[model samples]
Target chain A: MSFEISVSRRLGQGVIALDMAGGDGITALFGPSGAGKTSILNMVAGLLRPDRGRVAVAGRTLFDGDAGIDLAPERRGAGYVFQDGRLFPHRRVRANLLYGARLATPEARATGLDIALDEVVAFLGIGHLLDRWPRTLSGGEAQRVAIGRALLACPRFLLMDEPLASLDAARRDDIMAVIERVRDEFGLPTLYVSHDRAEVERLATRIVAMPQRDTA
Target chain B: MSSFLALTPDDWEIIRLSLKVSLVAVALTMPIAFGLAWVLARLRFPGKLLLDGLVHLPLVVPPVVTGWLLLLAFGANGPAGRWFADWLGIEFMFRWTGAALAAAVMALPLMVRAMRLSIEAVDPRLEGAARTLGATRWRSFLTITLPLSLPGVLAGAVLGFARSIGEFGATITFVSNIPGETRTLPIAIYSALQVPGGEEAVTRLAIISVLLSLGALIASEALSRRAGAGRGGHVL
Candidate 1:
């Protein structure tokens, strides 16, 4: 199992709960809007604390509420590609791509696990955007840069939250191909959140259906 | 134009002293003001409202009252003043240092307000993204929050510098006007008004003061507009 998550939390008069054991490839959380799909991603990334649960990725326990083991987000090593491509507006594309890799652990570097800046940039086809700022890029280009940034971190697993939700149909195909490449080439276990069933069916090796809870 | 060009040596000395005092005052208070602004902008504790009110007190109260409070707290014989005198051997009784301190106190509220507004405008989500990218909280703040709020910080510093240049009441009350040591532009202008045949000097000093203040205000306004633009052109 690449991802073993069993968590539940109360949010604004509603409860969100999930129990999933994912495979080594891509695991998609298939659900409609407001089904706490994004919340599950947040919990796995250590951004949101689960009320009572355990989250173990790649045999490393990131959060275990019963055991009182909750790591910080930076220490968890989750390559989170946000839905909105939250790139640093102050930095250029080159800097954004190298940000996480620059802070990678010395052990990770010595073990040859860190991704090179040039390789990720070339892989994402963002070489021409090296000197450009985040605000100057198109939505698709920005999302690619965001993906490159996460990949360069060389995270143990990737957590993508609706990475193509904002792109047009053409742009979505472009990102979908990138995701497929990441899955096949990099071989990194991924937990992808998406409301679109067709997109999940095309990419996810195993799909976990998220049930919507009615709020009183 | 000839008369304006022919400023006396004393006039130049007053201008130099004013610049020195204001610059030192701003340099000393900027980091302190930024820290206070960050606290005011990001944190919420039991006494946050009281702390905010206390920081803004100097802005609302009379300058003389602020000066008097400073004298009571930091005077030569006062507890803090005595502690510093004994240990640090620093005195603010009647020195230019006292003038600078008074000016810093008077200018702090404006600096804090400007910095707080900009710091508040920074998106916390960006910091979260940075943290998730393996950057620690402090690192994220330094790289993301600090850089994003640069314009506001510059605006605050310029505004503080302008306020310090015009500082008069608190400086005079805390540290008496000494010719080259403590007499700033405003104090010098006041002195020139009381002397016979000193109208030329007074007018020249007053005009200089107005020009300096107006230039600073314009620069601050421009910087604040840039700050808004930095936030993806969102007006706060």
Candidate 2:
């Protein structure tokens, strides 16, 4: 499915104007720390409402300012993985994985929990960590689990916000491989945010740059 | 020594009453504190500053003044009190329920403050992550926000309970110190101090109060440390 996003927002210290549109492939949002890359992903995920813009994924209007249509993040069907894993600390890994599945509508449950859970776990190679707590996982392992948790939600598109920024170079490579595999295997559109040009070059099929805002 | 041994019944009753009052206070204020903390930490509304100030007003107001306000709002013949008594047969004035209400009011600010800090400490990005995972706002809070903020919520409860256990001005002004009714440990201690040769009884009660407060503080610190360790050594 295709994903189209054009958003303009006034963030911390400047205005962020982002205009981009792409189809089923990894679209890299590349820029410096404050270049509004994350903001654009957030807009697409419906986490941040743009002052003026339209976000459409696969011809479905997720947000249209003039049309007064703004779907909440949950209804947008976009999988988002944050830089930090942000896993539920109190829940076991298995419980955290099922959290999203539990929120699925009744119609979505016909697919069966065991099938979805096993598929995500096998795909992410986190089968052994299911009973473990989030605190027990390394940086790379946690990110993998985070990705698995997001995918289990059955999203139409994936929005990743600097998911590899916190890992070491070796760990970054490891998680990067998983990300690419997911993108290719699922055949779903992916939007990745990153400051590393090498990562963008390696993973992204399309590049969207967010310009830095002027301080004065 | 004989008098102290003879008052065992009174001592047990006071201790039991204190625990009951603190537990009720903590229970009554927990959900409210959670709701307020979420609003303060996550959403930015027009009157947010005013609401924040109001939530914290009890902390700055003298306990006696707070007790007076509660009496005016919930005493017999008062608007809410009269309606409650007429409709639900609930009377709070000069009763154990009144003591719990006073303690809850006194303890609310500390509860909200601790919870607010912890909720604010949580990464908003995580909530965003939960949202993208098909969890609605309320669901996201229940699954992600609440669990992640558990340490802080526990700390808030312990702090509130400790504060309630020691609450004096408000409890006395609102409920009065009636044995087997509204008299908590602190109230009992205060009463013991009023009589001749009551020094020894006061000393024993004082020691118990100190131990309980210290225990709560230690528990809260341990919980916070565990939460921090769970987050990969990052203190949230």
CAPRI quality band, candidate 2 = medium
Worst lDDT 10-window in candidate 2 chain A: A106-115
In candidate 1, what are the lDDT values of residues A148-170, reduced to their tens digit? Answer: 99988868889999999999999
- lDDT string for model 1 (B1-236, tens) is 89765778998899999999999999999999999999999988899999899998999999999989889988987898898889988899888889999999999999999999999999888998898888999999999999999998889999999999999999998898899999999999888888998889998889889999999888888888898884542212
Chain A TM per prediction: 0.97, 0.93
Mark the 10 consecutive residues where model 2 chain B has the least summed lDDT: B227-236
Off by over 4 Å in 2: A106-115, A211-216, B1-7, B228-236
Tens-digit lDDT string for candidate 2 (A1-216): 477777788877788887777867898888899777877888998899999989998888999999999999888877778888888777789987877777776643443222388888988889899999898999999999888887877777788989999999999999999998987888778888999999999999988776776554
| Model 2: per-residue Cα lDDT at residue A206 | 89
Candidate 1 error regions (>4 Å): A110-113, A213-216, B230-236
Interface RMSD of each: 0.7, 1.4
lDDT of 2 at A161: 86
* Best-performing candidate as measured by DockQ: 1
